[model samples]
Target chain A: EHPLWEQIGRSFVHHYYQQFDLDRNQLGTLYSDTSCLTWEGQPFQGKAAIMEKIASLPFQKIQHSITAEDHQPAPDTCVLSMVVGQLKVDDDPVMGFHQLFLLKNDNDKWICTNDMFRLALHNFC
Target chain B: EHPLWEQIGRSFVHHYYQQFDLDRNQLGTLYSDTSCLTWEGQPFQGKAAIMEKIASLPFQKIQHSITAEDHQPAPDTCVLSMVVGQLKVDDDPVMGFHQLFLLKNDNDKWICTNDMFRLALHNFC
Candidate 1:
């Protein structure tokens, strides 16, 4: 597995667990300023804004199991698709949602520039 | 411009005009049964079902301009991305939304197998 993949996995886990213990600044540094995140049809732009929005969600605990992942890399751009299995609040298995992450390589690190996802509520109910 | 491109452009225009005057059945035949469409936040499956759902919408007039088009063709699959400018009902020029169409070549023709889009409402409002 690539080191960046491991980092992404850990970041997601940390965020899901609301373990705000991790350095929040790292999230902004890892994602690009132009990044667009659409969750359940709600749009949030930039890493700092998205971080604040997510932090505001009233979730006690959360976990995600990545079911499938596909990554395509070009010289400067990377497209990633993953099926995520989410467990939240009432311990309900929120089926799975598809997430497409578009990343651009800056210097030597990958920073997400576009993030699109379908929510469980939109898919199941 | 490719012949297939012209056909797609025409089909979209015909459907948008509420030219329910056009062959409605052709819509079903043009799209694959497994195609997925998400409008706003609601998800719909299959061409037949999607057509039905669209027909039920209370729209007086609709028009779309293709702002951008990108097509990548493999031996068996074609991926298309389009930015569509929509004009609907109240004569408002809705900002464009991105639509991704995944098509599989069957026999000699192409049919959409996966259709993913960010609706105007989801993107602008």
Candidate 2:
């Protein structure tokens, strides 16, 4: 395990949720204009499209409790992070979730190139 | 898009479903014994664990129609494939799904090292 890669993964997870909760606009800096997000099977390309999808979420507030995570440094300074967590959406039942991120190290800064998120419900939530 | 990688992705998607439908036993050959799988959030490690999880699925039969896919060749001869598709499970409502595979090219043979699968549904279905 690459310690530095794992550190980046942890920081990304922490900062993403914090920024998202404080102000989603702040989270835009974490992603590039060309970044893409896969929400289950639907695709959202570009930060503008990603923000639109984020804003359309059914819940007004959400919390993420990361339980397990792993990271792998890929070629071309790319990093793959897999996170397993519990999601609390407003007052709803705590939901299980899995998120994968492909990050690119650009100018000593890490930027998310691709993100994928899905619920853990067997029946799908 | 890497043409060869994309071709591999397509073949992997096709054969995975075909073999899974015919005989789950055949599917085990595609994954290494130490392979890991993330179903939404929960984790399944090792081929035995993965097969157990697959066998426990509620659906007796399932069909996968891959609609979109992307493949990136990573370091260490690993290929990352992201797939978006529609799933039909024993006459259940057609479900949208996203699957990610981290495959390692071992002597020209692609073996899945990490697999993730999730269904797309807004509410618990």
Which model scores highest in DockQ? 2
> What interface RMSD does each of the candidate structures achieve?
12.0, 6.5
Q: What share of the true interface contacts does candidate 1 keep?
A: 0.00
How many clashes show up per model?
Answer: 0, 0
- Report, for every candidate in turn, its global Cα lDDT versus the true structure: 0.49, 0.73
Deviating ranges (above 4 Å) for candidate 1:
A1-26, A74-76, A90-95, A123-125, B1-125
Q: Write the per-residue lDDT of candidate 2 for residues B1-125, one digit (tens) a residue.
A: 54586578668877887887776666877887778787865677788899888888787887778766666554455666776667888978877776788777767788888787766553333
Which residue pairs show backbone clashes in model 2?
Answer: none
User: Candidate 1 on B9-71: residue-level lDDT in tens?
Assistant: 345433533443343334666576766665543567778787887677666555555543433
TM-score list, all predictions:
0.42, 0.60
- The candidates' DockQ values read 0.04, 0.15
DockQ of 1: 0.04
Choose the strongest candidate by lDDT: 2
